[model samples]
Target chain A: MPDTTTQPLVRVIAAKKDYPLGHRIVQALRGVTLDIASHSFVVMQGPSGSGKTTLLNLIGGIDQPTAGSVFVAGQDTSKLGDSELSRFRAQRLGFVFQNFNLIPVLSAAENIEYPLRLNKVPAPEARARALAMLASMGLSEEAHQRPAELSGGQCQRVAVGRALVTRPDLVIADEPTANLDSATGAKIIELMREMRDRLGTTFLISTHDPQVAALAERMLMMRDGLLCDA
Target chain B: MTSWSLAFRNVWRNTRRSSATMIAIALSCAGLMLFGGYIYWAHLAAEIHTVVLSGHLQVFKSGFKAKGSGNPAAYALANYDEIKKLLLADPVLGPKIDLVTGQLMVNGIITSAEQQTSSTFAGVGAFPDEIERVIYWNPYGLTEARQIPANKHLFARKPELDAADPEGITIGEGLARLLEVSGDSRASLELTALTPAGGLPNMLSATVRQTSIRAMEEIDNHLVVMPITMANDLVFPGEPMHVTAVQLLLKHTEDLHTVEQRIDELAREHQLDIEHRSGWDLNPNHERSLNMLDMFFAFSFCIVGVVLVFTIYNTMMMSIVERTREIGAMRTMGVTRHGIVTMFLQESVVLGLFGGLAGVVTGLVAAWCINHSMILYTPPYFNVKAKLELMCLHSPMIIVGSFFSSFTVAMIGAYIPARHASRMEIAEALRH
Candidate 1:
């Protein structure tokens, strides 16, 4: 449902992923082809084990397609070495996980500042930017709190702030509000849409929640490792 | 936050495990330091014993060691005065020599008139003042040497051969017991020995001054100390004085090899027919003992190293396993494998530094406690019971060496686990 006339921020051509499970090859993704345009709010909706997570992983460069290419921000991710892909991810990509995977040892502000620090931003600027992101998320009161000390919604907001602090070209969120309550989940989706509109950053979110999928500007559904037109 | 601060925080995440690993490293380091301190104490004790008993170097006429045990007078150096003057006049060797004294060895039979007891005696005649200097030179300030017990005050009271008591002799404790002479009893003895001409036996009347427990327990029965003037008079009667060997003491034992080489050159220049020997040459058992201690230290060090490596390895492996999800998150955020490896290594460095410092403090306290304890034991071939002393060499080399050894082993232990964590699959680790 993406506008094919515009240049794509991510291009997947016949991508396939397989897993070896006890003498059987389980296909996680089979011949998935799609193009996501720049600055678009794209949502991937699928049930458990429907290959939506696999597709998101391929786009984020955290994994490689077994049979085809995944191009993100103009670089073919499958051709990059481990270290190069890591640097590529650091410079051009940001990821938000379903579990709100904040580093338990670091505080809210420190967690947000980490990706900026990875991109070689100076410490003072990184700190100021992290504070700004916390204030934007209404998390200024919880900036010094560790992940364990924060509520689930607060932890998820910190994770989202961390993903956007680097000002990356593409942000990938895999069920970013999975652990939050309905009210908290609706608020997170509103906050993310506000962030996308203000920063003009492209977002690719994968989830089974209809609330998350309903807010998508272009939504794609997957079933049995195959994408379906919506 | 910086990588270092993150690593430091991570180290304390599992408080109990980190402490256990640190304790293992600390104990190993302390054990090595304590054993090294003990070995250092033994070296000093043996050095003092050898140098104090025999001079730093001894000079004898050629063939004296091999054949002069029988009939020492035949190989005696009649030019004792000339050799002494020449040694004192040489600018190169004179300043290094602390003292040069002569000794005349005599084998004779002693008869106590009071007890009517006869015993074989091996006699050494020496200058009273010079002998006192050799015996009382306490450079290391040893407690035992500084305070001689009353019962063993024979050498402490009158180490010198008195010229006034012309025939005065210091007899061994065993010899005095055989004669049944108490410490307060004044007894007269007659000494008889073969004349230098190998003719009839010559006799000298003497009085016992004091009894001593000589160098070894076995030698106490046959030891006798007399004045060189009296021994010469009894041996040569009308001939000039002669001494079997000239003993040379140096200002420092480290100067032995240098002085020996110079002495060799001096002997070559003067055309003197003399052979020189060092203190270690006379006491090879001390060297052998030190070598054995060195081997023991090496064996202990290997054991400690192996145990410490495994302890640190197990700790780091657990840390890696516990933080699998965190590692995956960090990798997703663009942290390179090298960066992850470096972070873990930074944690290891902190742990090693803290453990090494604690070990040094603990070792020092233990050494101090052992040193203050007045434990006593008689070593092999020693007549007196020596006080056990532990002296930690306050050398920076030892402390720094121990610290770095523990630190390096810790780093090596962390290296493998860190690499494995860095190379982990991000997707799999996230699931974990």
Candidate 2:
């Protein structure tokens, strides 16, 4: 038996995914197995349509595997229903998107406070924690600005703040810097490293940017829907 | 931020689109309210006209309505005073009754001496003060009082009839015209009729005091108003007074059925074989008109509902399509499908509340403006032109119904799109 005391935070065993395209089934993920330890910063590098986003979606509980199983925080996500998966995502996982998907209507601080509010945190405490998170991102002066009012780097920081505000056990980022300039991309990558180090949260990122890949503690390469050894 | 606050802000994202949808809802609500208010006012006006033309309930001898038309005096109630006293003393009915009076009918020919013109006439004899109360003292006051045309004011004003003018009579304007009697001229006319017992012709003379415009165009050509005592003396000289029927006016028409029941019980106790008829029973044409008006109101309401539903549905569907990515993001941030639906519904509710409230306010203001305006038009079967008035604020049900219907329909419109949004696959939604 494997050691339970030092068991990985995420365990994927021979996971596979297939999507129906019109009249045919397209394989998005081939049989893949991986283990990510706690507090590890891992990056999966791939070109377009190489199944990196699909893998990130499976790990984040946004999609279920067509076969095999995915275990996150000791719960088998493949067996969970849609509603249970949603709750699991809320309590144990967070996501950062390529386009910095901060709710356009909410202020920067309010967007960060949203997940905490969903978790039933008291209003004042949620507000204070959102402010603290914003300050930590060096965005205290832009707390009251909406996504439309902020620059791309500022918006990405707010998105990062929102993902980490709930202190989830795992954070998944899909092409986080694809929409940003090189300078902004480097800064966002630096912020994510600092956050992972300080909060001891596991980070799983899918990217084609070498600057992002250079910061990964465990780097995996994917091509043709299969992960190859580094 | 709270879901409600988020929803509130989201609605304003597309200012022009949201405002247009809200305006559609507001207009629908106001249109329904105004049409409903007009129908209500028409109902009240028609009811009052019927009651004043014929009292709320009329008591007749057992066979009067069916058999008395051919020989009215023979089927007339002989103990008229006794029946009036019994009606006035009824414990359950007395307080509800506003006025009770006896009437006598005289069918005769009127001859204008100076003009040398003769015409057939149907005449009613009533108590002067009681007729005044029935015609003028409506519960709705000035709004109802204005329903009586200027030419008919004599029926509701001074000198409708009096002892000093025991022989004074009011005739319809068409009848006066047939007799060649103008408003400026004073004239005397001779009435000839057949007595009940002798079947012999009898004649009496009366001074033409006033001319009125009653409801029906045909009635206006042959109607005469006189005193009951004069009618009795002309029909049965020196005999005890007799009347065709006793008419009752009530404080409220809603109590007609209850009052009719009590009157029937009283008639039974007194051992009188009598039948009672309500205003609606006597005025079938008025009731038919009211039914058509009710149909018009229902048709208008359905139209408003359909248009409003489609408007709100289109608005919400477009909004959902535009925010597809944002919805996916929220789902990714741990908002449940139910949460997404709730947020959209909350936005719809806010729209409905604001739109419905604006509609009610606009409807009330429009009603006031119409009531105060001098818009006039002649209605079918009416002898005089009537004022156009809408009674919106007086009807609480219409106001509440308008708001509730708009709000409910708006929610229904939002629900379809919200459900669609909630069931969307996150991956496809993100791609959108």
Candidate 3:
């Protein structure tokens, strides 16, 4: 329902985000505009402190824009209340963190199943789907391993499976491979691109890794707080 | 995984902290239950003690309390037998009445000729069989102090009057000392009473039958108890018997109010001029002591509850801090703020349930041990040492109330921290 053959999966219009750093205000995003089309792998690449993470957060519906509107999966996320936004995210969007923030208490499979549970999927079906996603991530053997027991690359794979398990319309990853070595980071980026191709879901990832940026279907550059190429 | 299952797993994530918090909860709950058991035991002790001393209710001629002390002979009930019969046969009161008997209050001058001693006596004349029932009214079957070695002498059974020895008498230990008499010595004594109608004196001969201890020192110094017929013969001699008060002992203390109301109705219906006093009214000290104990228990419970809340709060706050990034991740997965709060509260309720159950078990065991240990304690203003006991088994409320209170305290303790965790901005939390 979200892929309007002519419309992009995500549309951000001159979005501005500011933070209060002590007494002075730091503007993280300055009138940034972008569109992420359905089934495309888009990378917002910038140097450290260039506001890529902030832009990704706004498009993820996890944070409200300081100004301008963010439309994801055909809904203006800025206008939604906290609870309404949470439901919208559960139904339409997925997120992957820079540090691979898998729940340390849950096993890899359980962590994948968590989002489906939030979506009110029946337990038996959620479990089956989570196991299938785990197999797809090439982590069938690590299904019962907690995040602490998994290597950095394996944990990121599990994280990717969890984000994609719900079959959401948009998967937003903020520096998903930042914590890995260059070689491992390339592999994670490869796995994500493969998942995107297999599922036909749009992905908007923020990263400074050129190896990851090299494989993006479309690459946008950022300088200071605004996108250099629109 | 369900929310509850995740919450359950999260609790054991830090086993040491969870154990410490549960221990605090368990100890507080046990303390409450134990003290509650003690209070329960005290209630039974006070109840039986009051009933043994004065019975459940007493009916006296109207105005007797105000004027009878000066001239009790003039205020004595003239129709004692009719009232006792009416109480025993009344449909409402018949089953509840354990014993209906009369007591005659008489005072006289007594002389011990051999000791060359003379003293005033304040005496009670009661039917022996009924008096014995009141002396031994142990409905709860609490351990009798008479069986305790240290208390055997003080709580020694009040000697029942011998029917054949109508001239027999029972005097207090202090009175016996003052008159230089002893039950073993069988000292003969004389009593002189003045008739109410005339100043004419009537003399009676009596023998010291038994010497017993009374609870209060002043009362022990002037007490005397004898058969009602002997008292009537000495005070009225050839007149129909008159009783100062009619004592009614009930099978259950709870029925005292119902029986008193029925007595009032009986008095009105029969045109009898009478007033009544319940056991609590007659023994005010016991009621006041129990009331003070209740206040102390409430105060102790509040302190326990407050301390427990803080202990759990500190633990919850620490957990929230450690899990900040994980919480943000969960929110990013579309877990709502309400879901976060529910998860934490579920964890706390689980902690409380386990802790409360452990406390109940420990308390019940401790109570059983103490009940069987036979530890003795001397009560306030009493020389005899009675057994210290707790009553948890017979009172389920002690266990249930302590458990629920601890559970509620645990819930409240988690509320503040859980709310703070839920209110955390998802972006800031992810950064942390």
Candidate 4:
């Protein structure tokens, strides 16, 4: 088995992200520091307005911190330009979403191959990687079908396949099972954990669901933009 | 496998929007292409007409254009051969020349043998072969009329100065009608001109060989062309041949301004008192017609732009409204604000390309159909009837220009929606 106590791949140093919500200045992240170690599944759990998704975004380098730093695998993403951050994301980060944001026009297989294309990966390699990822999701048969042609659970499977196809160091999932039924959600959680076990990759999730929170190796509980419990 | 494929596929997802936008683009492209094609054809046609009627440039005696009628014989090129050699010997201008012919204008009276009526006409003296080359006066020239033997017979006879052949002379179609003259195989007319010899005006007579009408109504109604050798014998008598004007054909029609400037310098240097006129200067009405065509094209382009903006804007707004949650999901999935911008821009480009292609097909088909249907038209200013001619050129420029325009319009329409999508908070998006 892989060592579960490996060094952290992502380190947040008192990160702060604020927004102007009408006349009030909303603090999405308030000097919150966190570490997401390699080969560990981490969950950020909170109710609405808890900044769980904002924390995930900061660590993934999709959004910059207002006052502090988000470092991924030793690189401070806050210092990178827009194009550089995108390249970094393509190389090191994978993302899965609650609504399974598979591009509706593309086939399930194409959705999985999108990031690979953006990275200008060779076609043969991209195709092989997409096929293997689809097989792992048990969606190889529906590879050519569009997202609209698939059910909610099937669409999420494609989204997961998409996230994993890049084979990135970190996977950030924002309520990946929020759109599925209980049984489908459970199966999805199992699939994620199974991938983690096989690949020895880190998974970070932001969710309010108790079931998802329970499956994490560690959970960070947030309330009103502050880390209440770890 | 390519980014292009991704962009293309996204455009078709909303079929209604895609088709609507595409149709809009296609209509705009077709409008521009067809109108542009017509303008191109008109410009070419006008250029040909100018060359056929007036040659490339005309040289007149210093006072001939101002007051030639008072003493027509006095204002003439005394050394015709020297001027002709100067025009034909220039290295750059020689190869482009077809003729350096001379013409002498005079007031004349015509009377057909078949009738007793007589009408005034304008007589033009020219070199038969050279004038034929410049005017291309054969029946095979432009229109689809059967080859007439009149120009051929005129070419063969090479009529010279002869007072006895008064029954043989060429009259303009309109002038022939006014004089009631028949250009029948056996029939002919009489022509008499008032020429000057030794500074004294004298009467001269010649025969009308054939009747003809080119595009110029004024020239056709009154022109009476005769050989330069014959015209000189009648007008100058014992003296040398004198030409009122020297018509020059340049190597390239587009080089008229340069040649005119050169001619001006040469005239000044050589102490030759003369004035040079380009073909366009002699035809102001043709220039006005071309300007009107340009205005029509400009108006059509404005219409196309307005239609395209509205079409693309409607499609993009609908797409943004439909894909609200999807945009949010992409944000949470680590798609940055710029990525969202790129994605939307890519979609717009795809739509523009596809729409432009469809528009090209649609426009070309409409234009081809219109062209083939023999759509005869008489514009407000023109007296002659002409068929609508659309020559699309099928060049890389038209295709690329049309496609770019369509794509740009789509981008403009999508700008606001894409901006709105990019601004969606990841937290708010994930909640939905």
Candidate No. with top DockQ: 3
Residue pairs with backbone overlap in model 3: none
How do the residues A40-70 of candidate 4 rate in per-residue lDDT, one tens digit apiece?
A: 9988888888888888878877677898888
- Candidate that beats the other on lDDT, 1 or 3, i.e. the better one: 3
lDDT of each: 0.83, 0.85, 0.87, 0.73
Worst 10 residues of 2 chain A by lDDT: A1-10
DockQ score of each predicted structure, in the order shown: 0.76, 0.72, 0.78, 0.30
Model 4 chain B — which ten-residue stretch has the worst lDDT?
Answer: B138-147
User: lDDT at A40 for candidate 3?
Assistant: 92
Structural similarity to truth (TM-score) of each candidate: 0.90, 0.94, 0.94, 0.82
The RMSD (Cα, Å) of candidate 2 is 2.4
Q: Candidate 1 on B1-432: residue-level lDDT in tens?
A: 888889888888888998888888888777888888777777777787777666788888888888887877777888888888888788977998999998888888989877889988888878776776766655676655334352355443555467677777788777778878754455788888777696567889888877776456566778777888878877767788888888888887788898889878988999999887887897788889889989998998888898888888899999999899889999999999999999899999888988888888887888788777766676667667666665655556667777888888899889999999998988888889
Worst 10 residues of 3 chain B by lDDT: B153-162
Clashing pairs in 4: B26-B359, B96-B251, B168-B207, B168-B208, B169-B207, B169-B208, B169-B209, B170-B208, B170-B209
Fnat scores for every prediction: 0.85, 0.63, 0.70, 0.28
Interface RMSD of the candidates, in order: 0.9, 0.9, 0.8, 3.0
Write one digit per residue (lDDT tens) for candidate 3, span B61-86: 99987788766787888899999999
Q: Write the per-residue lDDT of candidate 4 for residues B103-157, one digit (tens) a residue.
A: 7766657666567877877776776656766765322223211122223332223
Instruction: Report the TM-score of candidate 1, chain A only.
Output: 0.96
Q: What is the lDDT of residue B412 in candidate 1?
A: 88
